[model samples]
Target: MMVFTKYLEDFLMKCSTIGRNSATGRLAIGVGHESYESSHLQPSQWYGEVRELCGLANRPCTFPCTNNLSPSEAAEALNDHIASICQQLPPLDTTRLPAYLPARLIAPTVSQFQVLQKLEKTRVKRGTIPLDLPMHLIKEFAMELATPLTSIINASLQQSKCPSQWKTVFVTAIGKTQSPSSFGELRPIAITPLPSLLCESFATDWAYQDLAPSVDRRHFGNMRSSSTTHCLVSFLDFVLTHLDKRKSSVTSIFIDFKKAFDLVDHITVISKAAASMGIRECLFP
Candidate 1:
């Protein structure tokens, strides 16, 4: 766990440095493009002086400013801030699982908790899980119930089974504010157990990264850090820019899959993906 924290801090430091440089470049470009009226308001003239007056001029200013702290200091401050926030949040109630959860769904073991901790340290994607479980609470709960949880999970796995409770999901519909009862006005989202999600994430990362390069680039679904809609828009922009420049004609087709997840056979998809990559071993194997 300490090792994970150390690595996380180091990674954040590197990210901070990259972010600072990017921000600095953007600031310069923005200043350069400013009108002559605002030319007298040079950032270097006031940014440093104001920051110094606020006691925030010290290395690692919490808020974004020109006079920023060293990467290490910024990382440390970030780590401490996260830890403090987690400490203040309510702890998870491990004594009872959620309603309708299977009896076989046991609490997590220390080792399993460790695995979850490591997985949490990895890059998280947006819109994955709804619940925000703090790392500190996760660690505390894992330690409190490690032995029994370990035994239960191991027995279930040895029997080639998973707890039915773990597979249960809750879904909610969010209205798009267009009209009350319109079919297209609601977006349904599924919320699953954090433990199940953590396990799935570990497995998904391994398979996805391995197969991503070999898969067709145009099929952007499920690719990490890539958005299908964004790609489509970018392609459209490219085509339109060139068409306008050269006065050429271009045709485009748009396809929409309604409830795509509900219609797709995931097993078949994985099998076909493996075949496409020319791999003999089953993805699950």
Candidate 2:
């Protein structure tokens, strides 16, 4: 089971139409079956069928909330459940600065060239934002838009606050298995605004240089060239070394945390990360 916001359909439609024949009228059957001509029917008429062929919306979920609840009720229930688990941070402390950090820890100013540089690598984008401005359009106007974007980013950094619009996000709930009976079985993936994501990239780079030395070698999740496969390989090598080469018994235990990411203390993380870079003032508002 999978749950997606309405924005996903729009995003998929846009993605599908790019460099491909998404016209539902072209939908056809292989052998000993009926076929349809492009001129015969409207694409929207076969929207679901066309999407199926494209491997989109394969897990069409009518949330169990559909059983005995209205849309508003389901939304409220999901929101409440998410809020209960996701530990949102307290308001920003703007009045004072930590003694060890610099008095002002504003984000760095970005140049138009810097913006263009990042935009030019658009082809290498690893993530996309849902419900925000279209990334395709943003890439199309990258050059002409860089200067103003740089200005906006610089102003945002100087003021130490981001636009409220960036706060809006769509959370897609994906189930771990074919049938998910409860919210606990679903993983919430938050899709953010493009600008907010871009800003995060820049800010993360600010701390990257200072944060490298402090990172533990065993940490395999977010570091460069580290992935689940790499971790697995390392674990296997460790077991082999201990059991075969070093003549020791191998023992291990795996612990699973329910909705681990939802309980993150993000404010403390940001504070520590910023402080590591000699940045004292709060940037989030």
lDDT of 1 by residue, 214-239 (tens): 87766666777779787888798978
Measured against the true structure, the TM-scores of the candidates, in listed sequence, are: 0.47, 0.69
RMSD, every candidate, angstroms = 17.1, 8.7
Q: Which structure among the candidates has the greatest TM-score? A: 2
**How high is the lDDT of residue 29 in model 1?**
17
Stretches of candidate 1 exceeding 4 Å from the true structure: 1-116, 119-136, 142-160, 182-185, 228-233, 241-247, 278-285
lDDT agreement of model 2 with the native? 0.66
Q: Which pairs clash in the backbone of model 1?
A: 59-69, 60-69
Task: Give the range of the ten consecutive residues with the poorest summed lDDT in model 1.
Answer: 23-32
Local error of candidate 2 at 281, Å?
A: 6.4
Q: Least lDDT summed over 10 consecutive residues: which range in candidate 2?
A: 23-32
